[model samples]
Target: MLIILILPLLKANHPDFMNMATKAVKRAFLVALIPLLLFLSESTTGFIHKLPWFDIFLTSLDMSYKLDIFPTVFLPVALFVTWNILEYSLWYMAQDPNQQKFIKYLLIFLLTMIILVTSGNLITLFLGWEGVGIMSFLLISWYFSRNDAVVAAMQAVLYNRIGDIGFLMAFCWLISYSGSISLDFALATTAKSTTLPLVGFILAAASKSAQFGLHPWLASAMEGPTPVSALLHSSTMVVAGIYLLIRTQPLLGLNDTALTTCLCLGAISTAFAATAALTQNDIKKIVAYSTSSQLGLMMVAIGLNLPHLAMFHICTHAFFKAMLFMCSGIIIHSLNDEQDIRKMGGLQHHLPLTTTCVSIGSLALMGTPFLAGFYSKDAIIEAMNTSYVNFTALLLTLIAVSFTAVYSLRLMYFTSLKYPRHNVIINFDELSTPVFKTITRLCLGSIFAGWLILHFFLPSNDITHTMPPHIKMTALLITLLAFIIAFDLAKFHWTKEPKNKITSKQFSTNFYPIIIHRSVTTLTMNFSWNLTSHILDLLLLKALMPDLLKITQLPPMLMVRLSQSGLIKLYISALLITLFLAMIPTILL
Candidate 1:
């Protein structure tokens, strides 16, 4: 584990060496994981006990870590990181001059997430949390020359700072009430003391996962390189919040208010983002909104007291979501960075394999039958239906699930099935060996990884939902109905009618979240400027400093004026006065 953390720093200044270092780190993680998986495959419990050094490492640092869940979560995360790195090298950053630096950043980002997932103590978790946040800012604003990229990076950082406030509040509360930073200790706290921190954790998770009101940054984050998008959305930064809630499920399960809050937020976000995605033209933003939507479903699972299902979804979502982004990258890169789907068409003929992989990813995302998403997503929906919680949240989630299908199909229609829309007559094909292989591996995982992990890795008891056949089939039914709607919608031309344009515009602009965020930000900045520049600097500091200075210098000015007077008697008298004062002190002594 230490080697995985430290290996990325070796010879990082040299680009060539850094490339090799990343490859070596990937191998090191695989080597470390193989043994853990072997042990886990034998027995989930007591596997950590067998590894004496693991305990010693934790003891040396004087920090607690969740050993059992760590390996399970880390397996998928490690695989995703490895695949993302491979994609980063092959297609996304192939032409970039500073690809090596990007690779190093990605490795460090992976390490921080590792730190976060394994953390049993709040301090360690915070360290990892802040590390990922900083790395995200760097990676998102990679195209420093681009104004949008920089603004997007700033937006992400600022929104996450709000989440951090909640995180810190939870940390302080845990330490104050429990007298220990250990998550295990927090779990044992009374309901009265734990409720506030649980709320804090939910707030933090909402912001980090882009739930509802805190979701604009997720869409804006598309300005970054696609690989960064893949990594951030798939397994690292955004999922950090979901993982936090998953790790603290025991506490959350005890708090009714917190769980309800989560359910509401998740339901609203899933619906909002899915609706917005239906109108978006940017390929990456569509996928970004899909991510937010999926994250909301995960939150819904947590809210329904099904955190293991949330973890299950996270693991499955990572594979196809990463593949989707990478497939989008291939298209965007091929088209000279054109992200507007409206300008793209008939890509299935031009790039068959890439389009096929994208179709597979989209299908998996929509929770089509037997795909990776089907297992986890279907389970979540079923659980929501059977849940005795808010019926409104369940309704919103079901609507969002249908909307998920609509948008996914709409995306496929525009990018794959429609007639050619671009003026460029360039030949598009999946000829790159590395790109083909990378996506192919993910494609296979999209097909079978969910079943493999569900049967072998995940605890079966946690995911078992005994719902009626009709309720269980609701997700599939809604998805199919959405497909028919999408087919009918696709029959029309790309241009919108007069009445529809306004609604489309709203959805495409993320229903004014971006506008609202910008307006609020501008108002805050203007208010701050007025307070500082006009009130403090101009009125208070400028107005008072001169008077204060004059008051301080009055006695000195009088003394100087007296000494410089033209009258000899005044000077002589001043000199005599000085000598008299000096003699008086000596006499007193």
Candidate 2:
């Protein structure tokens, strides 16, 4: 684990660090994949390998590093996909002056994820957890000069901190009640009374996973670079929450309240984010929102007591989601960072390979039959259907499923289909060999990784488990409806221009986004004005100044008057007069 973590950081200090870091990461991932692949090929699974790094006895309990099947399985996958992201970034950040620093940060980012996944105890896991959050802040603010990037970075950090509070609370509770921060102890000692700690875990997971109320950060995170988005959305930041839940599934099972909370929150986040993705025009933001939506689905699976299925989706999602982000990066760069999909069309002529990638990734995301997403996504929906949940939760999950297809197709239409929107004569510029090769490999995964993983870990027929006809057909019907909705929505939004020129102008100008932007700006300005008027003006100037002036001036004025009068005699006369007036009041009383 130490060697693997250090490999990426070896060249982090090099002058030509950007290029060197990419090579280092790719090699490290490939090297890491070898042992994992070998282990997977073995006939026996669920083997526990212990590599004890630290050992301490807290009274009778053992606090030490240990390795198991779960971390072993996830480590190589994270390494492999993270390497792919780095390789993809070689081309994406090729010309960036700060590419070296960006590459260094990304390498550090991967290390943190590795630490989190391979952690032997909750304490170690939190270290990795905090590391990932810090790296996210740094990477998201890569373009620190851009106000949007700065805000996005701050938002990301703040949301994660909210989640961190939960983690911290859970840690404290576990240490106090269980007397150990080790996973084994926590899992072994589970009871219904463990709900408090479980609730903390849920809160942490919900925020980190970008569920519902805490989800705004995911959409706004697009202010970062495309590579940052790809790395973040795919394997590292968002997945951390899901991973924590999966890691603590045993403890989660102890508390019915925690499980139900996960279910409701997941359902709401899934539906809400999917709907938001449909209306968003920015390509990266759409993908970003979809990450949150899919995260919701993962949460739903966990809530439904299908943590393995959630992990399956995470593995498969990493491939296509990363490819899609990279494709978006390609398109955005080619068009001089044009992010709005409405302004893009007929990219098949200029970017044939990239367009194909977008189609494959988007279709996979839609859970189209036989794609990578199909195996896990369909399984998740089926699991949700069979779970004991209320109608509202079920409906929300189903609606989110359909919206996935709707927005996926909508994205493809505005991005790769329709007539050419660009006036310039376009040419087919072949992508650099490294970029093309890296993307093609990821595309292959997007096509077949789920199928292969499912076949090996969960056979194809295992997912179908003797369900009724209606139950089996649920995914199909929802997908079909999604296609229809996407087609109509696209036609309405992109194909047919408004009849009245003024209305057309309004639509073309994207009035809703403008309204939202203005609303936020207006609110912010009003807040500033109120602060200035109330806190600065009313409290400091109007209320404080005259009183301060009277107090300071009165003493000096009295001294000046006494000095000017040369009046020892006058002062005595004034004192006597005051005394006589006081005596007269007492006498009258």
Candidate 3:
């Protein structure tokens, strides 16, 4: 069944075949969703289908390969969200001549994510993990013409590789300790001290999900197409890290060190990202930072030992975040790719439907009452208040929550409400049929997905019932404050022109792009280039080898032509094939 779904994606390279391929992919996902829903409704327990691909037995241990159902609920979310993103991309990428190629990459991405979520063993999971990393590098750098996109793609891959190493270390520890690669075996193994594996898992989740120190890549990733942003940010790419933490809840529950680490990191990330979002003028960057912020909330939920709540929030956040990105995409296209919200205002007059959709998404993002985010976001906050966490975590989380509303409304004011600052004409009716259809569907999800998740999917409602009156009202009160702050900032634009020099400098220089470049990205890139490009490629591979010396001795002109003409593809293909071959023994032996 999955093979059938993947065929169209792999073959859909021509523009003539793209629409058909996209529809096939969407229908496949929709069809897959039904059985998933049935499984949930039937309250299915344990792995429904297990297929062992092979087995490995060393002198000391035996490990089996298999596929399982730990991410059963997550499968539906992945399918539904991927389906919508595919549908939306048909509209979003309609103008691009290379859209067929883009759709192929997107489908391959979904396939990898599906593999990640359903894999029963750590090894297969990591395979999918690395697969997504590769796909993301391709997708984020899709518009390779842009210098920023190229840099952003590299940053994303490097950051995720840092996380990948953590997963590798954990897998090694688990295989040594438990003598198995299965998740159940690892969880069931009673370790004298779980410090190594637990810490490794935390590091993996933090980097992959863009938690704090490893977070600079996510917001920078806005250089990609908006549909890519919608898919990556909303349900697929970012959620992988959260899903990893959720899956290992039992192990995380065992150690205070790991749990406390999650709490602090999540709290700090939420506050930091929300504050960063408040300062961003780029419409997509604001929403990108919002993703990091909301992801922090999910991390906090995991820290508080409520995996279900985190999953619930993941489902709800998926809808509105995707919608928000789509809305931002529309505005960007309508105004000829203008992303600065400062340049956009009074768009309600030009794009009434998009305006309304963006408003609903913003309200939901801010956790307004009865909206999707309201249901989970409010509950998460209430849980944070009542949990056995320290004041610092609680306070930081609450502050982050307030900032969510501030950014949400700030986006609204700048993009939809204020007087038109530019005399640019927009094609009010440019939305394609498929695009409008997907947007409408997403708006519905933004409005009601939260309530549905809370009622039908989550474990219980008793957590909210135990909270005090003030705790119940905390999200609402802070939201009101956020509205006030948004209105003030919108009207005054204090962020644009701070009275004090120090204040102006703080707002201008402290943003992530500047800070990350100065602190981490530039340093890392230089170090990597020194190690790989100069030390390995130039000296060890080329300079020392006699055949390579002969090649280098070729005329500089001929060498350049040879490299540019066709050798590059052969090299890439050879590298990929070699990597795949190297992994084969690990899987099959």
- Record all residue pairs in model 3 with backbone atoms less than 3 Å apart, i.e. clashing: none
The sequence of per-residue lDDT tens digits that candidate 2 reaches over residues 426-459 is 5325478766887898899899988877754542
After the best TM-score superposition of candidate 3, give how far the Cα of residue 61 lies from its true spot, in angstroms.
12
lDDT of 1: 0.81
Instruction: Give candidate 2 regions above 4 Å deviation.
Output: 38-66, 426-428, 458-464, 499-589
Error of 1 at 55 (Å): 19
- lDDT per residue, candidate 3, 1-589, as tens digits? 3675676855565556666666666676676666557655775554424555555565222222332333555666666777778877877777888878887888888888877777667766787888888998999999899999999999998888889889889888887787776777778884735788888888999988999989999988999999899989987889899988887887887788888999899999999999998878899999999999999999999888888888888888988888888888888888887888878899999888888999999999889999998988888888888778979999999899888888888888888886787665776584567768778888998898887666556463356456678887988998898788778876777336555656545665256557766867688888987888777777787678965767767678686676565667778987899999999999997
Reference-based lDDT, residue 42, model 2: 71
Give the worst 10-residue stretch by lDDT in candidate 2: 504-513
Q: Give the per-residue lDDT of model 1 (tens digit) for 1-589.
A: 6575465577688657555655666676566666567655676552322122233322323444566654455555555555445555545677789877887787788878877887767767888889999999999999989999999999999989999999999888887777665677767774643588888888899889999888899999999988899889988899999989987877888788888998999999899889888778899999999999999999998898788888889888988998899889888877877899988989887888989999999999999999999999998988887768788898999999999998898888888986878755655557677687778888988999788767755553554446678887999999999988887878865435455555545435454775787799899999998878888777788778986788898989998876786998987898999999989978998
Q: Please give the lDDT score at residue 320 for candidate 2.
A: 92
| Whole-model lDDT per candidate | 0.81, 0.81, 0.81
Give the per-residue Cα lDDT of candidate 2 at 409.
91
Rank the models by TM-score, top first: 1, 3, 2
